[model samples]
Target: MLLPPCLPQQCGKDFRNSLKQPSPNYPYGYKTKKPRIVPAFTIQSMQKNTIVQPPPKCNIYEPQPARPTMFRKSYKRGEFPVTIEFTLSGKRLSWKVPIEKLDFHHYLPMFFDGLAEGNYPYSFIVEEGINDLVKKGSYKVLACVPQIVIPIKRALETKRPAVICHALKCIQMIVTGCDKVGEALVPYYRQILPTLNLFKDRNRNIGAGIDHTSSRGENVADLIEDTLQILERYGGPDAFINIKYMIPTYESCVLN
Candidate 1:
């Protein structure tokens, strides 16, 4: 808009000075404005923009149950505890042993005592115990043979034909059951042979009333025959020759 002229020269100078000075809207130096206050994000506003993710699924592999290797079936026979099973010469045999009547440790000693005391019924019990051990395996039979052999050999030396025959039968079972056992008894053949001669002609029912027979289905005499055969088989042909040579020496040792 048009304005009036300055009245004086000083007034015109003052007006030029004012025009040179910066206006309030357009200041010479840049003046920073106070910072604008921005309100913080609330939980509801954040939830609207948030990206929800589901948990990862795991793939766990579980194994199946294992099968048993031994005794598949339970003992169905009477109230027989401790079913004994073992393999011999590729044949597997199982027997149910009554624990009350047959204790393995005292079996051989008690058998010998039965013979010593002339208790025929007790001898049958002992025979049953031996049969139980035989059914267990050759290993069990062989383990007890060393202990059994001593008493059985002593029994052979006795005057009673029954005791001698019973002892021979027991020896026969042990020796024939396993080849290893037969080989073990080979050294004792010389000692056994001389005793066997005493019983050669003595024919009597040594195992009377003993219903439990040998595993080979033989009586005492037959058992002695089988045992001698076993010893001959394992002792080799040289064993017979050795026995011939051993006889004179054994005779001399006895005579002296």
Candidate 2:
């Protein structure tokens, strides 16, 4: 008997021989066999081959440069050095100070306070810087004197004699250094004269042996004398007459 082509040769021979001697259950040809079960290893092998792979990882960390601050940009405006020259103790002195280093606007109040308190070293440096600026005849420096005069006058009213004296010294330096600056201060004379009057009778020797001979010294008499000289120079010869009229008796005695 011929077997079907779909079956294996050996299996076909066995099936053909069984067909010839059919059992009562399969009388016509042959009974249908049950389906074969697949192995677990075959299913695992198919799953492994069908899996999708992941893509390559990217680099997350990389260094970056730092950004500059606001102050760093503002500082660029004051980068230039300003060379200032003035006389201190009858000797010529000069300093090339960076514009940023001279924070005058912020420290001017403290400077006045220190001057009034007989802080000579600090006062001298400040006064000399002003004198140097004036001597340079800088329009920018001269323009600022008008605004500064009133504060200096206010400083004259401090209860501390040393402070009053130093304020006077600063005024003297301002007036003596430039005519325009002196003229600018003329209007404040009324406010200044009264303060100077308080120190007229003060004859104490405050700075005696300091090597520096400056109006910033603690010597009360020198301060009064220098202030009077500055007033006369800028306020004209009749400047004392104004002071005299303000306080007749005291001015008369001082003048005499």
Candidate 3:
């Protein structure tokens, strides 16, 4: 609406200056602290807008369980001669049934052969009436081997010597039921000696003489008596003869 038209020049100047000043509605200034589209320092995590599908999580392939190891057969009843092959090296060794399979008992010859040639898997057999053969003085054993430290542990671990000896003896005993010391004791003595020899020299109880008097309650005579009794049980005439020939003269000053 139209009103009074005339105004002073100074009044017009003041009015223009008032217009230039900011409006009272926005006294603190138009640029107040606004909600930022891209925040300076964000609290909430950014939405993963790039659609980052992770390189598909790898399906970890677990290996299957290993199968149990199977071992070769020990021996068969009907199979007279058995050839055993070594697992690691594939070396072959054999044992044969003798013609005198019913009575033969000397393992020393076979043992010596195997030891000399390094031929393993030697079979041990004890046939019935072997004691009769021994009694007849037919079982003659000539040992060519000089003393050496036999590897008992190695043989045992590899299922040799002792195991083989035991298995063979078991088989023979099963077949023939021959219980002869001449055959049965030889393997035990031979296999055990190298280790036992270590103890023999260090003999504490059984001293220089068979009839030695001791301050300690135990006596060699008693021990001898006990051993003799045991020998009577396990040793036959052949064994008694062998023991008489082979065992060191405890009555004499025979060191080990």
Candidate 4:
């Protein structure tokens, strides 16, 4: 029953042949399963279901302070009052006050533009205790306009150039009293009547060449009368006379 060595060689070829033949249990070799794929529509639906919320506003309910209301009840620069007014319920307010030793040329327009726009809750430091209210702060309901400016360009243009210049000189003397001469400012008023009358006489002498034509004579008179009205309001001949004396001898022609 024992096989020979040649018989074992034959057995090895048969074993190799069995491996090459397909078996019923695994007919198509080892099978590989495919992975399941997610759909694009499902991903988009998830994104659509998500929600986001924004931050709340800081000041929505506060009411504005009443307008033209007096504040602190003290005079500024020794002449003007400090007053304030509100607009937009509780949203904004404005302040009217004067500055001392401060030129309007530098501060006015900047102060005015801010008022025209709603940029309050701000501040400007004038003195140690006083802040102009438009300073550094967060958005809030109680917005304050710490400054107000009145425009006077029209008033300036309507006045005669010479009269305007003269008024400034007179007002300076009346306000400051810087110059003291013999009879000081007194002789200045006495001088005014003569100078104005002189102007009239010169107009008559010039006749047709005078500023007033025959047809416009009444109108010219009205203009002069209006000027006189303003003069009376602004301290009259007394102030004018004082200003005349204050003029240096070298600049005397300006008074005329």
Best by TM-score: 2
Off by over 4 Å in 4: 1-99, 102-187, 201-224, 233-256
What is the per-residue lDDT of model 4 for residues 64-141, given as tens digits with 9 covering 90 to 100?
332221211112232222334445674322334334433433343233322211112321112111223213111110
Q: Cα miss at 219, model 1 (Å)?
A: 8.6
TM-score of 2: 0.46
Candidate 2 stretches with Cα past 4 Å from truth are: 1-121, 138-142, 204-217, 247-256
How well does candidate 1 score on lDDT at residue 70?
13
Q: Write the per-residue lDDT of candidate 2 for residues 1-256, one digit (tens) a residue.
A: 4433455555766766765564555447655555444344455435533433334455222112223322223324543233234555563335565433455443333333334333434446556555565555444445566556556665565546555665776777666765665656555667767756655665645665643434447766567766665665576555657656654544333346
Task: For residues 1-256, write the lDDT of model 3, one tens digit per residue.
Answer: 2223345655876766655555556657435343334432344325432232335555332222322111112123333343444567654443454433432333322232222111233322222222222333333311211221142222222322233233233222222323453235543343532322222232355455563333442333333333333433454444444444444432221211
Residue 224's lDDT in candidate 4 = 36
lDDT tens per residue, model 1, 1-256: 2233466665766877665554556545445455433334534334443433434455221212223211111112222243333456542324455433455445544444333322333345445545555555556455555555655555565545455556665666666665566666666666666766544433446565654554434345455555565565665544555544544322221113
Worst 10 residues of 2 by lDDT: 62-71
Clashing pairs in 1: none
Off by over 4 Å in 3: 1-82, 85-108, 115-195, 200-232, 236-256
C-alpha TM-scores of all predictions: 0.44, 0.46, 0.20, 0.17
Scored by CA lDDT, what does every candidate get?
0.49, 0.53, 0.33, 0.31
Residue 176's lDDT within candidate 1 is 64
